[model samples]
Target chain A: MSERLHDRTRLRPPAPASIGDRVEDVGSPALLVDLDAFDHNLAQMQGLADAGGVALRPHAKAHKSVAVAQRQIAAGAVGICCQKLSEAYPFAAFGIADIHISNEFVGADKLAMAVELARHVNLSICVDDVRQVAAMASAAEAGGVRITVLPEVDVGHGRCGVNSTEALSRLADAIGEAPSLRFGGLQAYHGGAQHLPVWVQRRQAAQRAAEAVDGYVRHLDARGVSCPVITGGGTGTAEFDCQSGVYTEVQPGTYLFLDGHYGASEWLGQFRPRHSLFLSATVMSTARPGVVVCDVGLKSVAVDSGLPRLWSRDRSGWLRYVAANDEHGVLEVLNGDSQALLGSKLLLVPGHCDPTANLHAQFVCLREGRVVGLWEVDARGLSR
Target chain B: MSERLHDRTRLRPPAPASIGDRVEDVGSPALLVDLDAFDHNLAQMQGLADAGGVALRPHAKAHKSVAVAQRQIAAGAVGICCQKLSEAYPFAAFGIADIHISNEFVGADKLAMAVELARHVNLSICVDDVRQVAAMASAAEAGGVRITVLPEVDVGHGRCGVNSTEALSRLADAIGEAPSLRFGGLQAYHGGAQHLPVWVQRRQAAQRAAEAVDGYVRHLDARGVSCPVITGGGTGTAEFDCQSGVYTEVQPGTYLFLDGHYGASEWLGQFRPRHSLFLSATVMSTARPGVVVCDVGLKSVAVDSGLPRLWSRDRSGWLRYVAANDEHGVLEVLNGDSQALLGSKLLLVPGHCDPTANLHAQFVCLREGRVVGLWEVDARGLSR
Candidate 1:
């Protein structure tokens, strides 16, 4: 029993890969980031944001890594956007001065978090209702901190935010009335419009969203209210949004790690999204002919957008991720040798980067086919 | 700057709920387990396994909580099955002396974990290939641990395991040759058949799997190899698997907390699976007339099986979770009041329990509409 207790004490799960280890030696089902491609993506997005004259506030909800956010800030991002109050904790702790909660949140607990976060950073949060404003203002006052309040306007997303100008005005008025709150700007984001697949459809969606934002801005202007910053735009529609002249700041999270869904989209714009993130999965089973099962599945990668695409250097398309169970990803070997593939590590570009990144505890930072570092997905599962 | 640093030091995300908080007062997008229903589920599964005369080894992959596993152990579960080596860490650390890795794994890292775990616990792992056997044997021998090897046979679960008795015999021989290995019987599981929806179909599938197991056992018997345990079953087929008389032990994970997918299935069996688990989501947005968005989405719940069903006490079907974004669940109000739902906490029955449970850090344990305790999701993202 003493030995058993000692053994238990010594049992620690091995890290996916040590620093300087080759990519092939990394453990299966690891979240991997190609540092070269990541750097390229960072420079590219920064360049685009610079040329377009828009403040880049890359959403940290996609990576949830302080390292990634720090790199983004170093590359000239004005701030970072987090979808939840808890998600912004790590970035706040890491001393990222500006963080925005890009989604609506309620409850005293969330308000308390917002207030707490406001004390450390230039914390901003979105709200679509007057009740939320009152609660947030009360918490901010109680905590002796001022919070930037953005009234999210439904710019054709139809998910969250006020659709009507009256509702928007009410929220803006409420924020303006609160002494501890500053009416920062409008959160006019059309999340659904970001992934229309076709370039023309996405452009049209962005145009409609821009028009809606213009209307909301004009309405506020008519009421002698100056909208300081209009924050809303994702990886898909950032190019068009920057050209819209309506959004002062853009939040493009997936731009850093272009996923299978984004890669499938027609990118006629200047923003070149290279696939930087990958699920390093090993071909665990090759019992059946023409089929191999990898160690990645629903737990390792998100299938909300679609099954991950097998990332091949030559775009061979020999192996296709056919299905995903809890801990197994079934891949159909179209023309490759399944036997030879056994025990070999394969890179999978996830369907959705945000949720897929949220699945892993850390990202194996890879450079020149070797692990350079491991970055903790610090705010992972911080959905509250 | 010092004040900011001090504030950052104090910035910690609050717990979802305190020990004595009311159910409604708990934070949004929290994983909740109804203790009453959970206890009922525990007793029911135990009763089912007891009556069937089969040892119950509940799968911990569904609820990776040590507290839940402890409860299961106290309630009569022989052991627990974790899919990944890393996932079994907390349970083993918490003094779970018996554990089974019910899936095949590769890599030196995983083998090392297997050997290390074997030292403290009765660690049994599944394998389909002879190559895996040699590596595992070497690791176990070097670690000075006797690791039980279960040769997984593909009983219609085409994902993993050997299809033929010849291959199975080869694996068994490989285990027999290994000094630090024990041939612990077969892992004949059909994961795809678990959610067949129809009872007769599931029963037929279970029977076919039983026949397959029986054939494999006979092949081993012909070689004078005694198969002490034949373990393979899940919530959907536990009833039929136990009755098969072929399986000495049945592994059912989801029976303790039935998800929407399992709850939707036609259960004509004696095992009464109850809905114990829930995703506590708050209606954060009610801007649209008929549509309200909750704070639970891809980050909070798994939508791989299907979108989460709104769990209402009255079963009025007033609201339907139609779509899920990264952090938002769009619920369409069907003949109900959207305004009334705003700021109200709604219970969501996840589409799938395993992956959904993987998303949260802790489960807000509830008893009679009050928060009783908070159980950490010990192995929340230990996919590696």
Candidate 2:
């Protein structure tokens, strides 16, 4: 084996950017975080959360940066929520005091990792299955750590969690009995509702999710389980969640780094975030008559939601990103000036923020076309 | 800033795997490379290339592992073609002598990096623009190194490269006149043809690409520019490229690690690689009755092509990977034993191989369900 391949930690470096360099000089195909816009988004979400009297636990799963998470907490987030336990490691290692694995921890290895991580931070995890609860309880007991266990109530996403109040009651009862585990209320996240383009559709989904949380809180209360927290709301449904009157905490992640996918949504149009995440790709090939090819492609940005918007140009209405190869984005002229030079940088607003953020090694945090810092995507590839 | 966040090198690790560990004990959401099948694939591709009298340069953009690239070179591969210049660094640093950037290198930073890299290894880059040729010639001359240049020709993809023979001759004449560059050959890569579902469609596309290459090679030859090599083709079009009698070398990446997307295609069905790349996620939540939520989703696997197929069991046709959130793959039962327990390890054949491989930090190379070695995705995040 090659020695370089054997030891795996040396990541690809801070490409095309020094500490004092201008933004135009920063590397193509970079995950550019407009720190100015990010701060604005942070303040706006915090203000909304505060006005509604809900504690903001900004989901770190969107950006997965220790810096961003810390900033969110500094801006009055009660804590940060991670979608995976392993995803919370770098954050906890960086002294992120409180961390919650908003999603369930399944499997022995992962459960053990969660228990191990609990020793370092104020940790809480969601559980929907009795087996998951049992495994967590065992790991917590073995590790001699008291970890909070949130019983997940399936609040219309229909992906995971307990469906009925009876199921919630059973899981909550199991959690309450565990000496090493504390019952930490309900994990009632309406992920499906978070992306419904229609405002009314999203509101109704949030309402359904809220009702499920309310029904479970009532059920658990009657069964002598004090439900003090109900956490679940994303960038799309945070408004409804904060005003729901039941959720003590709302987890809104993508609001900070809103992308083209969320930007097009009428549901999230009210917040009107200044698209923080941008992919600045170099126009590598201008060989074709009226077309210029960009260096960013599917590998540079996530396309699960949709293609990134041409953020640098006002001709986006008709200037088409026709196709994308592994490392090339083909820009064709439909009506506008598509004659970009061979090395000009074109800003791309990522389609989806979270997965796109996870693809990059570091976020080129910029302010006014100048490099402020390079924030490591500390929890990138931490899917576990 | 936290010291850990700034340095950004020490990655998440449980590296250096021990043999004989059970598959269930492996970490959740891991990129598992079946070594047994991988070796078989190596032999198969070598044999196929040998029979066709064509060289195989397995695309490193698929795995980005120096170990895999070295293995390919050892097993009769000409070299490895990386999609990015920086991506080829770790491989070059690891003593894999020859590397090619299959994609265009734009921007002053990237071109300079490419020239600097040439001092260490045999470097070649593909370009279609005259300005790209001019810049590269200047860089090579200034650096006192000779770098090979492949003038890319658009076959049918229409993503990048020049179309006309007149343009090709112009770029070739520029390379021919340059003191620091060698006109290597044509980069007639039919990226579109590589993923066409039908065998006939792929063959036709390859034929068109071959004719275009022949036209360009003849055009260059008539102008006194010797064209010795022709490189292109991928897993889907490897057979067609090898048999085309025009391509001197074929670049097949995903053949070594076949995924669900390639498996569904009739083109690659003949060479069904033993789903080498597998994602084993824990059944984190099985509380939704018929639904089992695996803690592997868009973050773990690339959904650009399609959802992953349930691989550990034979019921993949019925056990549907219904939905995927940021960190959850919801597996539902259309018909089959979908009652996976909380800790049951379910294997997944990823949708697309390239981006899916890019998503993970390391590949847990497994032999007969036993942990072998941890292969680092060495060149990951080198998008620049």
Candidate 3:
């Protein structure tokens, strides 16, 4: 075990940049956080949530950095939401008292992890089935930890959560019967509605989701059950969600670091998202005419949403990231000299921030073209 | 620095499976290697290389594990190829003396890394530009290291490398002039031809690439330069590449762990690749009828080549992984009950093995339903 640890310590690459280094000195394929924009986005989202009268729990799954999470907490966030039990560990260990695992889990291993985490922090989990409730209850009871349970009601996401009111009621009753469980509220998240592209469509989707949650809440109220918190929403639909008057808490993760996917979406609301995250890549090769390959590719950025866009301050659109291979991102020089771009640093706005941010070990926080600090991606590769 | 190290130690999640643990006991979204099939792949690839009379230098960009690389070396592999200079550090530190950076690099940071690596191992790197050769020569001279330089010639990949024989001659001459640089040979890799579904198309592409490389070799020969090595070829075209009588060595990274993309390709040759790599996922949600959500998703697997395919023995096509979100894989139950699959484990053949392997911290090696070993993905995120 000691030998393995030694190997790991040796295997880790040096951080891309150090404090007080120029932005160009940062290594290629590093995740860069524009601190100025990051701070603006943070305060902007907090103000939006405050104005909407909803508790703001930024999803830690987006950044996966304890430093970012601490900033979010300091910026008036109520708590944070994690998509997995293992992903909640770093936040919990770093003085984060409240965390909600906004997803479902099963099996003895996951149950053990959940119960163990409950011992350290105020842990809440979502469930859509009676079996899951029973298993979590058993594990929580055996661990002597009270786990706040949220019956995930399918508010039109159609992926996870109970579809019907009866199923939600059954899950709530099952949690109520468990001595170590507390019925927190409802998990009404419409993941599909987050990126509808059309403003009216997004608004309507959020409205339907809110209506479904309201129906579930009314059903619970009729059964003499008190619901305290209703948490849902993402960066794309947080405005509509908070305005729906049905959700008590909103979880907007990507609002702090807008990506190409969200940048292409229609934004008519007051919550203006700034592009805080950028992939610092170097032009590695300019062998082909009119085309240069950057160091960022499938391993450095996520392409599921779409290819990353080159960050252009003047919107010149001179360089287009056309394709991505495993270790090379092929960029076509629309109107610039490819040779001049060689060895030059370019900032890229990743298509999707979540998976792209997960690819790097640390974030090179930049302020006015100078690296101010480095933040560890604390929960990277913690998909378990 | 000590505080940061402590935080990193606390941030890392526990390994999914300990040695000798049951296969089912492994945590969800863990990279699993079937030892029975893995050993067969290792021996089979070596046998193929022996029969073809070509050197087998497996690309470490695929598995990125020292244990796997050590096994390959023990099975008669010549050396190993890494796509980046930073990636070669682990292999060098772990006592692997021969390493090749089979791709081009630029910038002072990359040059420093190359010089540092050359001081520790027999480091070989590829270059296509004279400017790159000049920079590398200066770095090697300053570091007092003799670095092997391979001129990369474009042999139909159309992404990197020099295009014409004139360019190749210039690069070779530049390398020969450098006092600290040894003109190793040529790098002619047709990455685009590696995944053609039709066998004939792949063969023709390999033939064209071989012919182009032969032309470059003749050009070098006419210039009174003796090329010691001609390296290039991936898993998809290794068979044709070795028999072409041009390539002295082949770098077949994915041959050891056949993926869905390769499985879907036509293999009319004797190289019977086996599916040894798998993503062990468990069903976490069965909320929607006829569909079950597994814990494996974009964070756990690479979707660049295509979506992963469920591994089924007996041709039972009961489950299909239809969609992947950030943290959930939606599997459609074709003929089986979704409820029965809840909390059950399923082995998934990743679409592409390289990036998928990069997503995990370690691989759980399973032999006869029990974990025999855990191999760290030593250079998991060393993309720079």
* Among all candidates shown, the one with the greatest DockQ: 3
Per-candidate TM-score, first chain only? 0.96, 0.94, 0.96
The C-alpha lDDT values of all candidates are 0.89, 0.82, 0.89
Clashes of each: 0, 0, 0
Alpha-carbon runs more than 4 Å astray in model 1: A1-10, B1-8
lDDT string for model 2 (A18-66, tens) is 6677888888888888888988899988988998899999999899898
Model 2 chain A weakest lDDT span, ten residues long: A2-11
Window of ten residues with lowest summed lDDT in model 3 chain A: A1-10
Question: What's the alpha carbon RMSD for model 2?
Answer: 2.7
lDDT of 1 by residue, A1-384 (tens): 001223346566788889999988989899989989999989988888888899999999999988888889989999999999999998898789999899898888888888888878898999988999999888888899999999999888777888888898899899999999999999988888888999999999999999999999999999999899998999999999888888999999998999999999999888877899998898888989999888998999998888998887652468888999889998998986787777878888999999999988888999899898899888999998
Best by TM-score: 3
lDDT, model 1, position B47: 88
Residue A353's C-alpha lDDT in candidate 1?
A: 92
Task: Evaluate fnat for each of the predicted models and list the values in order.
Answer: 0.60, 0.57, 0.56
Ranking by TM-score: 3, 1, 2
- For all predictions in the order shown, the interface RMSD in Å is 5.4, 4.3, 3.9
- Write out the backbone clash pairs for model 2: none
Residue A69 lDDT in candidate 2: 83
